[model samples]
Target: MDFHVLELFSGIGGMHYAFRSAAVPGKVIAAMDINTNANAVYAHNFPTTSVCNNNIQSLTPEKIEKLNVNMILMSPPCQPHTRVGNRLDVDDNRSDGLQHICNLLPLCQGVQYILMENVKGFEISKAHDQFLDALRLAGYQWREFILCPTQFGIPNSRRRYYCLARKKEFCFDGGHILDDIPIEFRMGVIDGMMISNLLLPDNLIGPECYLPDKILSKRVWLMDIVTAEARKTMCFTKAYTYYSEGTGSIYCPLNKKEMDIVFAKVKELELSEESEALRLELLKSLKLRYFTPREIARLMSFPNTFEFPTETTNRQKYRFLGNSINVHVVGVLIKILCS
Candidate 1:
């Protein structure tokens, strides 16, 4: 049950949180990421752990050897392989870190299990091919999953690609190395919790742990989204607050009649025909505020005690939450492989 974890590109130590929060007995020996902001948050939450803010390409075998961890968990940068990105694949500079990790796979004597999470497009990317090739060459068997939080009953719909690889010595039953082998084969059903179930009662939730009420006071459409009977929404990205187009889900609890009435008002006010600012004001008036950092963190399955530094801004917090992994979902995956 002893799991020594090495976290690569460890944004906010999401994997580290999963490793510890799950039933598995493990500790992250070291976590590496180049983003100082994320490292700060990771350090804030896990003060005792070693968090190295450095490029992955600089992660030498000697460094891996020193940590001497038995498992690797990472969610490498997905920009290069993302649909909106340049789709540079393995040619992208960001991929260098993962490539470096791949190179170290054969050299790192203690690494036995690997769990990599990335955007859905990653499965088809050349970078994925390179990663799989490395694992195969290193004699590790892997299973691929295109999983979403909704599958486990959490409302946020973040469909990601996960590759769970185990050294041959600890391999699964020679299963399809590129398919979503049922985790249920080993781990039982993960208890389902609706988004409403996760939220603390309004009276109990701190008044200040949310966006300012005045900004979204008029936006009636921007109400509780994770309510009972309706428990789902879209993926959250770093652009969550900065760009609302496809960022993440909102808390809108509007009913069909109410939605029609709101749209009718938009048409009546001709807000769509006005300046962008005016249209935004109209939208904001619908009570559509960004999910408070704490709410988003809760949706992402970060525990109540997980907090940002006092100086961290809401925008920065949103970015961090959007980038961090869903602890509950990832915890299930780890339990499946480790338990």
Candidate 2:
């Protein structure tokens, strides 16, 4: 059966792409977001779909009902639930969008399926409670998951919270947290997944990706460095490239022995200007660099057909990608949810 979908908080159409990747027959009636750059990217890629630049809170039950959509896919603002944030949740002004959606649920009776993605901490929030209450009041049965892309045989470690709800009978009996990726939903080879498989040809990795000497000398210790052969990477945030520690992993194009030598010298260095200079030089030898946006997109399981418009800046690319979902993982979830 074909589904009419309304995507809220759509960033570069990740949910739309994932929906298509699921091989589910669907039409995205409207893709909505406030970010102009993201909307531009979505429009560029999905010329046939309507991309709306509007705040989620402004979406009324009347407006949504007019679309006659059965499925609602959303990735709401996660800042309020992030560990680093104040954890204001429903109290945070940023959460107004999701809270508004909850208010609309009861009035929009035609909506049968809802899928949402957010940071891992969301399940515990007051916003989550409100959402659950709304779903229950609307006679929807839901399942929640705390999944990572690694579970889907992707090398990246983006542990996130997902909720799949439907108005139909809950055929798949389960508790709130899905502990495993059901065999039916599994894709890719778990044993063979590596960062190397997602990397671009060396020629495409430009010198522009190189880290500055200042960051190398001061922030090297905090960087989560990984080689191409490695199977995992830290979760990349929008702050990637702008921040070093905890922002994301850096690419290290050096062998184990070379990395060992460089780190050993770094450990021995005193807190002096001379030591900082030596640290910079040592790190420079490693040729450490940020993963280009394209590499991150690949790691996120975006298809090769995905492309940023020529006018989109590198920073914009990283920001949109960081905000987006892992298409492959979400695709599997969509198949399970829609089935």
Candidate 3:
């Protein structure tokens, strides 16, 4: 039987794409989000699925039961937990929607599987404790992971937390629990394994967007330096494109030679196609002109076919994507839960 899914905060259907890529017999029966632009894009892409354009807090358990869903997948907004905004505001309205998920858990009468994805820092929040408590009280068996995209062979180093919970009766305790799994279990699962593993090799592009030879040569050195202060580095959420403008940008403690080479590369190209086909291809692979909406979508592992509505501004698109979850990460959790 095909598993039916309900996706909450379903920005541009990244979770939908992940479910599809998993080759599982599943269908997204319903999706909900408050952002109209995101909902427009979601509805345009998923014409048949019921798109509920409303705040998640307004959704009642009875409403969700109408979908006949067997699984629920969600990535609630992370602004409250995100270091970019107010750090620990439990009262933040942006984080309020997460409470709705907790409230709705008991209403998921037929849902055998559930997954939640969010920023890594979410684990520290009191809201996370409440969420976990709800699941445990509901007799659900669960597992969580702090996963990095690079571990999954995605080239990018986006890291996020993923949780998979299932009704106790159907739970696979051995695979779902990750306390002391084998080394094989610890290995990152890349996207290519489930879908086409094709990725643009680093050399085939132009000089404009490429990391400079010096910086490339010293990547290990930079990594070592950053490792010493990873806690500080990981907290930064500046866009890569903003590095040139000196706005919200981050920098490694690279030496003058490395910095000069990196800046030279950044200055060489406009966001145009001429200076670098590789940059263009990379943008295409990631899907966007600059590192805004598309980069966020890429980090979230949304499929190339996903589209934004023409009616929506690019800025809004970027906001929605930034708040979304990495679907590939969710898909792996689902696979393990159902195995």
Candidate 4:
């Protein structure tokens, strides 16, 4: 099966990379996104492919028909349904683009397969019901999943919602929906290592990767700190470096004995300017740091070839990656969809 994909809300071409890695006979005919920063990165990586910087709402059936793509890959704006967001569902202006795509489904032609991903809470949203209605009205059969990278032994926990749909004429190979990722897709040692085994050597990591003494002393208690030998990491968000609690995991290179000693001294001090200064001094010895954007991309299953433009800032890279999909997980699904 040759897949000519129309990628919507395409951020940094994660879906395009997944398609290439899936070992399927496919190419993205055109990718559409309104984010200028994401558009620059996408074009940097996929120079031959068309990367349109246009709003989804502006798409017409005629425009879509001209592409004649058989598969549609999209990760709509997740802000409205995210746990930290306002939970506005379909009412949020950010979701208008997704609603526009749903409305366009019945009118567009040759789109036989559709795959969408979003935050976990999206399953219960009114927009999701509207999407199902559109799929049904367009004569498609569908299966939904809430999957995490850890299920495939990747060692990072970023649970997300995924939906795969095909025209009624086609059938899913075993056809029964499992609440979990199919057992056949489960594997160990993705891209040659789990997170525990993949920690980059200090020489490869830059000085900027280390957490500042200010952040270390203030939010030390709230951080989800892990060591190089740990098998798992918390979900990393766009707020990773900007915010402390619940945003993401921090790395500590110190061994158990050294880390314990630092905490022991912290316990002896009370809350005061003098104590805070002492605490900061003690915490500095532990040598804690954040996982670099490149490291986070590795955890998200993006290939080593993936690169942000030279001009892209660290914050920009984090935001784009946080909004992107797990390439390895999606590659497996793409194979399943084509099968």
Q: Highest lDDT, which number?
A: 2
TM-score to native of every candidate shown: 0.84, 0.95, 0.70, 0.93
Can you tell me which runs of candidate 3 are displaced by over 4 Å?
169-188, 191-299
lDDT of each residue in 1-339, candidate 2, tens digit only:
789999999989999999998888978999999999999999999999999999998888889889989999999999999767789898889999998999999999989999999999999999999999999998899989999988767889999999999988655666768856666656634567888888888888888899988888778888999997888998888989998899889998886677888888766665434556676677788889999999999989888889899999999998999889999888888888898
RMSD of each: 4.3, 1.9, 9.1, 2.5
- Whose TM-score is greatest here? 2
Which residue runs of candidate 2 sit more than 4 Å off their true CA positions? 187-191, 268-276
TM-score for predicted model 1 compared with the true structure: 0.84
Candidate 1 per-residue lDDT, tens place, 204-320, comes to 554444334443434334443333335676688888766545777555334546655665766666644665455446554444334667777877778888888888887798878
lDDT of 3 at 122: 80
Predicted candidate 4 versus true structure: per-residue lDDT over 102-184, tens digit per residue = 88999976899999989988888999899989998888888888888887777688988888888854443534434565556
Which pairs clash inside model 2? none
Report how far residue 312 has shifted in candidate 1, in Å: 1.3
The pairs that clash in candidate 4 are: none
Candidate 4 residues lying further than 4 Å off, grouped into runs, are: 168-178, 187-193, 256-258, 270-274
Candidate 2 least-lDDT 10 residues: 268-277
Cα error of candidate 3 at position 214, Å: 23
Q: How badly does each model clash, as a count of residue pairs?
A: 8, 0, 1, 0
In Å, residue 136's CA in model 3 sits off its true spot by 1.4
Superior candidate under TM-score, 2 versus 3:
2
